[model samples]
Target: MLRVSIAQISPDGTKEENADKVEALIRMARGADLIVFPEYSLGARLEHADRLAEPVDGPLIRRLAAAARESGLAVIMGILESAEGGPYNSVVLMANGDAIVAHRKILLFDALGSIESRYVRPGNMPLTLVRLGEFTVGLATCFELRFPEIFRSLAAAGADLFVVPAAWYAGNLKEEQWLVSAASRAMENVAYLVAADSAARAFVGRSLVVNPWGHVELDLGKGERLVAWEISRDAVDEARSALPLIEMANQHMGTWARVRRIY
Candidate 1:
């Protein structure tokens, strides 16, 4: 069994304050194997994000890495990545005081009158999957949840669990959309989905965990808190065995069969 902690943070202070919240959350979830945080949880600066952007080896990331390692916990969280062209929105999975995988957000949040595309560059690179205990984990950011294609591709690429760190904006029907999207993605791919959302003033805090059977396991409704849930690979196996969606698609020999993409 793998224990995962979800840290739903709505930071209301300076950079130091945000870091303190992260440390406090990690300390609170000391026995969890892994912990996830929302986007912009590190710097407390969601707007004008480029100003506080940093490389993976920068001080902020290093400090976070050390803190998680010190707690004997693996962490996956979002940050603004520094680059010459695209200071991308990225997620880092860290262990042993080092980053194991950094996944940039492929889809920018350009909807709902929020033009993230204006400041952040879209991650054109392929998605990266991280290794957890007996599970292949796929990483995505806020806006990616709107696109089922990305989730489908991740499922095809051998990912059994989806880890999403979202900063979802509060607006008409947005909260319902968040819940539906979480359940839909899990049912469509027959994989577990974990959503860690920011409960900031502008954001509607409804972090969710959906099982492979499209069941909502846990939902943190409108608050800043940390919660844990235990999952096992046997659950994934049971879902796939019942659904057999992957089994139906991957058996054909198409010309582009090298990647095993489902139509």
Candidate 2:
């Protein structure tokens, strides 16, 4: 079993404040095997994101790596990655004081009048899957959750757990959408889904963890909090055996071969 902790925090405009929150959460979740933070947890506002950008190996990430090593817990968090064209909203997975995997946001939020594309560059990288303890984990950022194809691809790549770091905006029925989408993904793929969302003022604060059976194991409501839950590969296996969706899909690949070719 892998013990996971989710840190839901409202990061301000300063990197120092965000780093302090991460350190505090790490100390609080002392025995967890992995801890995840929300997207843009390094403090980047849409208007002035350039000022908050940092290289992958910048001081902020280095401090996070050191903290992960010291706490003996793997850390997954999002930050603004300084790049050639523009900053990419990316997430890094840190273990043993080093970054093992990084994923840039493929689906930028350009539909909500937020104009994320104006400040951040879109990424075209492949899905990142890494071994974390007994689980093969897949990483995805905020807007990527709306795309089911990404989750399907990760499942095909043998991911047992999907860790999503999101800074989901709060408006309309967005809260309901977040929960439904998370549960749907977990059930469809028969995999555990762990989503850590920001509790920032304008964003939704309900961070959640869904089991392979589509059961909500942990949900941190609209406030800053740290929640921990136990996840096991056995649960994933059991869910798959019960549903048999993935197994059937694999067995009947020829059915979709023509569709894939056409698409």
Superposed by TM-score, candidate 1 places the C-alpha of residue 175 at a distance from the truth, in angstroms, of 1.0
Poorest lDDT segment (10 consecutive residues) of candidate 1: 247-256
Model 1 regions more than 4 Å off: 43-46, 252-263
How far residue 133's Cα lies from its native spot in candidate 1, in Å, is 0.3
Using lDDT as the measure, which candidate wins? 2
TM-score to true structure, per model: 0.92, 0.95
Compared to the true structure, candidate 2 yields what TM-score?
0.95
Report, for every candidate in turn, its global Cα lDDT versus the true structure: 0.84, 0.87
1-263 in candidate 2: lDDT tens per residue? 99999999888848778788888788788899999999998885977788777787877778878888999999999888887778889998889889743799988999877879999998768889989898999889888888888898898889889999999999999999999999988888899999999998888889999998888888899988888889988988888888887778778877787754455
Local accuracy of candidate 1 as per-residue lDDT tens digits, 16-70: 6677788778778888989999987765354767776777887767787888888
